[model samples]
Target: MESMMSFASDLKSVSPLTSGCALIGGVVVLLFIKKVAISAYKTFLRPAIDFTKLGKWAVVTGATDGIGKAYAFELAKRGVNVVIISRTESKLEAVKKEIDDKKYGVEVKYVVCDYGKFDTKARDMIAKELEGLEIGVLINNVGASYRYPRYFHELPKEEIQHLLTMNVDSTVWMTEMVLKGMVERKKGAIVNLSSAAARYTQPLLAEYGACKSFIEKFSCSLNAEYSGKGITCQCQAPFFVATKLAKMRKSWSVPTPEEYCAQGIKWIGYPDDIVSPFWIHATAGWVLLTIPQALTTAHFTQVLGGLRKRGIAKDANGGVSPQKTKKN
Candidate 1:
C-alpha cells in the first residue's frame, strides 16, 4: 500500500507538465484549422465585390502592356469605364482601339504621362485629364525594376533615380491626386502592384525589393487610415507572372498576365491589405514562410548572383538586356 501511494505521487508530479503540453498542442491545432478554413473560404466561397459600386471610372497606370494592360481590359469587360495611362501615346491608342474592338460598351480614355518623369508638369497633366471623372478605382501599376540584378554600388546613378521616381514617387503622387475625391465620395479601391520580392531581403535586387516593400507598407497603412471611410487600399504581391518585366513564360506556377488579372480583379474591395491574388501564388507564399529566413535569403543571393553574371556576360557580348529590349 505504501509503494502504491509513492507511485501515485510521482504520476501526480508530472501530470501538470503533460497537461500543459496537451493544452498547447490543442490550441495550435485549432489555430491551424481556423487558418485553413479562412483560406478555403476566401479562395472558393467569397463572391467578388462589385467594383461598379465604388465609382464609374477606373484608372490604371502603366496600361500600355503587361499587367496594367490586362487590368484595363478586365475592368472594361466588367462594364467599368477605364482611363489607361502610360508613357507612350502610340501604345495607348493601340490598347484603346483593342478595347473598342471588343465592344465592352464602356468608354476607354488614355493619358500619356511618363511616370519616370515624376515632375509637377507630369502630375498636372494627369490631374487635368482625370478632372471631372468620378474616379472609383486606381491601379498603381506603373513601376520600374532593374534590367538585371546588380550589386548596389554597381547600379548606375541614373537607374537609381529612375527607380525612385517611377516606383515610389508615382504611387505617392497619384494616390494623393485621387484619395481626396475617394474620401469625399466614401467609396474607392486602390490596388498597388507590389512584388513578392518585397517579402524577402533580396540580395542583388536590393533597391527594387526595397521600393516594393515601401509600396506594401504604404498600402497597409493607407488601408488602416481610410478603411473606415469605405476606401479599400490593397497591395498585390505577385510572384513570377509572365510579363515583359519578369521576362518569364507562362506556366502553372507563373501565370500569364491575363490569367493573373482574372484572379486579381476578384480581390479588390476586400479587407486584406497585402495579398497574393492567385491561389497558387498564395500557396507558394505560405510555403515560403515555412522555410528558414536565412535559407531563403541565401537562395535568392545565389540565384540573383547567377543572373548578374549572365547579364554581365550578355553585355560583354554586345547584347541588350531583355528588359531594355522591350518596354515594360
Candidate 2:
C-alpha cells in the first residue's frame, strides 16, 4: 500500500509537466502552420494589383541594366508609360530604344541625372522633366554598394559620399518630389528597393546595409502615413539577383532580374509595406529571423572577411578587381 501510494504521487507530479510540454509544442506547431499558410497565400493566391489603374506613368530610377530595367519593362508590358533615370545617358538611351522597339504601346523616356550628385540642380532638372505628367509609381531603385566587402575605415571618401547620397538621399528626395502629387491625386504606389543586407547584420558591408535598412524603415513609415490617403509605399528587399551589381550567376536562390521582377511586381500596392517577393528569398528571410542575431552576424563576418582577403590578393597580383557596384 505504501509503494502504491508513492507511485501514484509521482505519476501525479509528472502529468502536469508532460501536459505543459505538450501544450508548448502544440502552440509552436500551430504558429509554424500559420506562417506557412500565410506565405503560400501571398505567393500563389493573392491577386496582383493592376498598377496601370493607379496612373498612366511609372518612374524607375537606375533603369539601365538590372532590376530597375526589368521593372521598367514589366510596367510597360502592363500598359504604363515609363520614365527611366540613370547616371549614364548612353545606357539610358539604349534602354529606352529597346523598350520602344518592343512596341509595348507605352511611351518610354530617359532622364540623365546622377543620383550620386543628388543635388538641388539635379532635382530641379528632374522636376522640370517630369512636369505636367501623371506620375503614379516611383521605383526608388538607385543604390550603391562596395565592390567587395571591406572594413568601413578603408572605404574611400567618395565611396561613402556615393553610398549616402545615392541610396538614402535619392530615395528621400525622389519621394518628396512626387508624394504631393500622389496625395493630390489620392492614389499612387512607390516601390523602394532595399536588400537582404538590411534585414540581417552585415559586417564588412556595414554602411551599405545601414543605408538599406533606412530605406526599409522609411518605406514602412511612408506606407503608414499615406495608405489612408490612397497611396501605398512598399520596400522590396531582394537577396541576390544576377546582375552587374551583384556579379552573381542566376540560380534558384539567385534569380535573374526578370524572374525576380515577375514575382516582385505582384506585391506592389499590396498591403504589405516590406516584402521579399521571391518565395525562396522570403523563406530564407524567415529562417534568418528565427535564428539568433549573433549567429548571423558572426557568419557574415567570417564570409565577408574571406572575400576581403581575396579581393586584396587579386589587387596585389595586378588582376582585375571586381567592378564597383555603381547602381542596383
Strongest candidate by TM-score: 1
What's the C-alpha lDDT at position 163 in model 2? 95
For model 1, what is the alpha-carbon lDDT of residue 242? 93
Q: Work out the TM-score per prediction.
A: 0.93, 0.91
| Cα RMSD for candidates in order | 4.3, 5.0
List where candidate 1 sits over 4 angstroms from the true fold. Answer: 1-14, 320-328
Per-residue lDDT of model 2, residues 1-328, tens digit only: 9999999888788877798999999999999999899989988788778878888899999999899999999999899999999999889888999999999999998999889898999999998999888999999998988878999998889998999999999999999988889999999999999999999889999999999999999999999999899999999999999999998999879999999999999898886999999999999998899899999999999989999988886677576544543232
List the candidate 2 regions with Cα displacement exceeding 4 Å: 1-21, 317-328
Note the residue pairs that clash in candidate 1. none
lDDT of 2 at 209: 98
- In angstroms, what RMSD does candidate 1 have relative to the true structure? 4.3
